[model samples]
Target: MASPARSLNPTPPLKGSFPLDHFGECKAFRIDYLKCLKERDGAQYECRDVAQRYLQCRMDAGLMEKEEMSKLGYTKSNSNRRRVSQDSYKKSKESKGFIAGLSK
Candidate 1:
């Protein structure tokens, strides 16, 4: 007797796709992390700050679920602290007339 034929359909992609950053809510931070990874020759540890910011932005914007974020090492308190530090850094740079690669 002949064996039953196997199904030939390909598996469907995930509902929304992986690497939620495609939603664009946190594209800038995602790009920064990508650039950092390239600069560091793919040393993920060297890009932790940028990675964290990208993850935090996705979480804040609801593009990614909190559980998923936590699974990837995100913490609410850590994000809050990083936000404050980033804000201060931007303020200091602005005071020095620096605006995203332009300085007077």
Candidate 2:
């Protein structure tokens, strides 16, 4: 019987954790993505935008590296250019409320 061959180049273990909630900046985006997933019955494609925004927030906060973000399907140009405003925050909450109503 032939012996099993070992791979020459093994994938390296991930260096660090992608702490999604370590910073409060991306909390809203994360929640939105999670809610979207639940609403869509775990359909990841439905929440791609929210997920991207959350990842962008992590990248902006230095919680995650650009290379790591790129590996996760985010592009360099996706970096957040402007800060979140109070008006937008209120709008997000209102949208969340609307989504919650749909779940009932």
Candidate 3:
């Protein structure tokens, strides 16, 4: 069997974008992208994975601008704080597949 550890190469783009009905919503992952993902998937998902899939699903969507994920924190260069994996961070940024978002 292949390793689930093996990263998922991105396939074709999903056919959706962030909704406008949330005219008052925030643009960051927690609000905008989370709504997008929940609408895409019937069930709710965590922000990290949803954000990753969003960047994957939409080919032209802007990448997360923050240098560090709010969840994962910083790296060894961040000597003052505990370190985390940059590679893992990048991998998280990558999308696996469009597991949902099929209903629209």
Clashing pairs in 2: none
lDDT of 1: 0.74
RMSD (CA, Å), each prediction: 14.7, 12.7, 19.1
**Which residue pairs in candidate 1 have backbone atoms (N, alpha carbon, C) closer than 3 angstroms, thus clashing?**
none
- For model 1, how does the per-residue alpha-carbon lDDT over 7-101 read when each residue is reduced to its tens digit? 99888665454555555888899889999999987866557778888877876887766546566766667667776787688688878775466
10 residues in a row with least lDDT, candidate 3: 74-83
- TM-score preference between candidates 2 and 3, better one: 2
Clashes of each: 0, 0, 1
Q: What's the TM-score of each model vs. the native?
A: 0.49, 0.50, 0.19
Top candidate by TM-score: 2
Candidate lDDT (C-alpha), each:
0.74, 0.69, 0.44
51-72: candidate 2 lDDT, tens digit per residue? 8887787778877776565677
**Model 1 ranges off by over 4 Å:** 1-23, 67-71, 74-104
Native-to-model Cα distance after best TM-score fit, residue 71 in candidate 2, in Å: 3.4
Candidate 3 — which residues are off by over 4 angstroms? Answer: 1-32, 36-46, 60-104
lDDT for predicted candidate 2 compared with the true structure = 0.69
RMSD of 1: 14.7
